[model samples]
Target: MNIPMFTLLVGIPLVSSPVVYLFGRLTTRAQVLTRQGWIVRLLALLAVVATWFPFINLWLEFQARGRRMFFNIESIWLQLDGISFLLAAMVLTLGTLAILFSGRYMAGDFGEEKYYAMLLAMIGLMIGLGCANDLFNLWVWFEAMAVSSYLLVAFYREQPGSLEAGMKYVVQSAVGSALALLGIALVLAQTGTLDMDQIRLMVGTMDLNKAGLLAAGALFFIGFGVKVAMVPLHTWLPDAHSQAPSGISAMLSGVVIEAGLVAMLRALSTLTGFALSWGWLLLAFGALNMLYGNLLALQQSQVKRMLAFSSLSHIGYILMGLGIALVSGQPAGAQGAAFHLFTHMLMKGLAFLAVGAVMYALFHEQGIHRPLVAHDLNGISTRYPWVALSLSIALLALGGLPPLAGFMSKWQIFVAGFQSGNGWLMGFVVFAAVNSVISLAYYAPLVNRMYRRVTATSVKKGSASISWTMQLPLLLMALAVVVIGLFPSLMNWLTEPAGAALMSIFR
Candidate 1:
């Protein structure tokens, strides 16, 4: 009954997705609608938890077997390393919570079964992309992730905005994939192998034709940029993240785009290998992404859409960490990037879920027509205290206020910036700091709606109560954010090892 753990890690959800879908479909015939939802939920939970074991098993093996990278499938193929394990931890943890949040958010939707299937499938694909050892396999996994995410974005097909956003996402994604494939073809032509290490070694050489190499590098960078939603390429995100279901918003902002960065990291490792020139280019874009995203976010009235732009700004922080990592070969920047990814995923996921809770209480169950804005959310702190508390914590954290999850990660990135020994790096750090303040410009209105000022009004009583199923997830994430901020050291193990291991590849 023993299965290759790697296969188990990837297979559990891929296999169980169908089972959950069919079970959900078959159970539709049952008279008890309530039981049907819980049944599907239980199955999805088990599947996610099963996939999560790879991280736990990896830690045990590292302790017992003392290996940095576990070649679960051996050297000729996909492997699991510290970085892969760390990212998998984020993907599965958030994936599970988002699904749980969906229980109430999607309670009576007709397409609930398909939602389960697609969400689970997306998580598995992301894990596969992170573990992939060769360029071709990484591309395959990336494509799968893209397709599933597009479907998930447009899951509420009845909404015209949802359909429009999904079309834009897929079309842009296809163009990105084509450029990625072209880059892969060029690498294969030059190196005669799809192996990442060989590609890196070949491209790293001085004798390779510089002209052809640069063109391939450009294609790969632009291609991955589309997924990472790097500013100019980021138009699809605000719509996709906002129009999709709130649960999907959490996933999209939380881990889906980070998956693109993960693939980009793999591509960069194999194709460019610490090319300082490319790192400088990333540095420039990091600054622009921060400025552009925050400014636009200031104009957003829709809650989810505002968070969507905020996500674009956070990507700037992650990229800044990475830019320093590549340009200066500072492991601190990479470590900070990993930390930001972990913290941002939790913070953003919680923020979306909290918003979802408000929407659930206000729109879904109560049928209020209040626009999704701060004005409408006035006196919310008194009404839905749980949602208000969680939402407020998420907002402060996103704003990089101290003593919260967001501040610690951003501080680390800034410290890493200072450590880079380049005065120019300070300019990037300052620009980021300025953008952080700019971000506060938008987050303030939301905060005001929650606690700052409220005029008593006779609104419907008992209208904003959220179910415990949704409340618990929001509270758990809020607690985690506080705990992590108070003791950032909790993540030092994973972040340090993941950063160090990946950087060692260059040395």
Candidate 2:
């Protein structure tokens, strides 16, 4: 049967999630294929590959048609907008990489069936959230993603910290979802429509006597703020990221928060009159995140928690770009945000995967009791040289060094701020650059530990053979960071259509 590209992106992962569980169970029950675990691995691999087809089709379609404001494939079950298309493509790409990485990461772990199932389910919900055009539909998918993530965060149910982190995540997300629902209700009461495009048009014709728009905007911002883990609302992030599986942590830090930002941007697009106030709010939060996240990261002894806090700070940079887009009304700001989102995905994913490799080597020797100090990872460069190299590249990219994807994105955002003539925004961007330098203080120590420090007696023997499943994702993401940095036109072409789409919403 034929399906639209949008439907396939959403459906394939949603459908395969259950199938993975069933097939995994079947294999276990029969006891005939225990030795051939590769079969189940291949099946999971195929599911991820299937999801990529739609993005390929999307690229082809964009090439055939000029970068228009919108190109949609609408049906009873699925709807696609240009903005949704770009975000969905990002979700799919990251989802595929995460799943591929997990195949190796989870190889020896029990409950592989459930792990793969939840992974696919989260991917499906991410696609749903990205492509949803109506407020209610967006909320539904948002909750779906949240539920899956909560379960995934606590996937190691035996670990008390994991369970506690998951509980905290769910409770905070529930509160955020309730606020979003209230905001949606207020908007629907005023405009009698849930469609984003319709709401944007309706806002222009409505009276602003009661400040209902502002109230709704505040609610929406608070709701999505929690999702993106903006300051004050971000209590659950460090705990969850530190406790969860590394692949899931990568997914959470890399793509899930980006999806939340996309939702907030969509909501903000509906209330153009409040753009200045919202822009200031975004700017304030972004600045706070950059300052707070990095400084807190410096204090953390645990490697994963440090990275989690760093992720929070980088979210601030992206939000700054969004704020510029709103205040300056420039496509360049939006384009920069998109480029940053893409590069952050690769950089963060590789970083988490590197941590996973370290954990895999040390889990038996040290158990979870041994703290992961910079010194603990000493001699990893000698043992797993490729992994060490990949991790170094990822860290340098995260630090926004030249000839890397992160640098390209950061440069564009700073240029866009300058072009917009927003002195305050430009100053904030400069502050972010300073924060990036501060971040290097923490990140550089880890590299030094890996490459330069002498191995201690506590260090364990590293794995002799790195699995293809794990290595493939890191390699691909590392290469992507370099490729996109060298040739930025590829991302610019993809993001132009999306920028046009948001611009049309205002028009």
lDDT of 1 by residue, 1-507 (tens): 877777777888888889988888876655545446678877887889778786687667765654555355444477777678777888988998988888878876876888998899998888888888889889999999999999999987877888999999999999999998898888787788888877877777746767777777787888988999998899899989998888899999999889998888777677564468777878888888898889899998888889999999999999998888887888998899899999999999999999888888777676543336656667788788888899989999999999998999999989989988899998899889989988988887787877766733422443757889899999999999999999999998778877886676544
CA-only RMSD, every prediction: 2.2, 2.2
Tens-place lDDT per residue, model 2, 1-507, is 867675676788899999988878776656766655555667777997888887678667766865532434453344455677777777777777887787767774667788888888888888778766778878888889889899999988988889899999999999998998898889888888988777877787767434888888999999988999999999999999888888899999998988888787777678767777877888899999989999999999888888899899889888888778777888787778777888898899889888777776666323443335667678788777878888888888888888988889988888988999878888988898898889898888888888898874455453445677778888888888889889988787667777667655544
Candidate 1 structure, TM-score to reference: 0.95
- Model 2 residue runs over 4 Å out of place are 29-36, 67-79, 208-210, 364-371, 462-464
- Per-model TM against the reference: 0.95, 0.94
| Residue pairs of candidate 2 with colliding backbone atoms | none
Cα error, residue 467 of model 2, in Å, equals 2.2
What's model 2's TM-score?
0.94
Instruction: Tell me model 2's lDDT, rounded to 2 decimals.
Output: 0.81
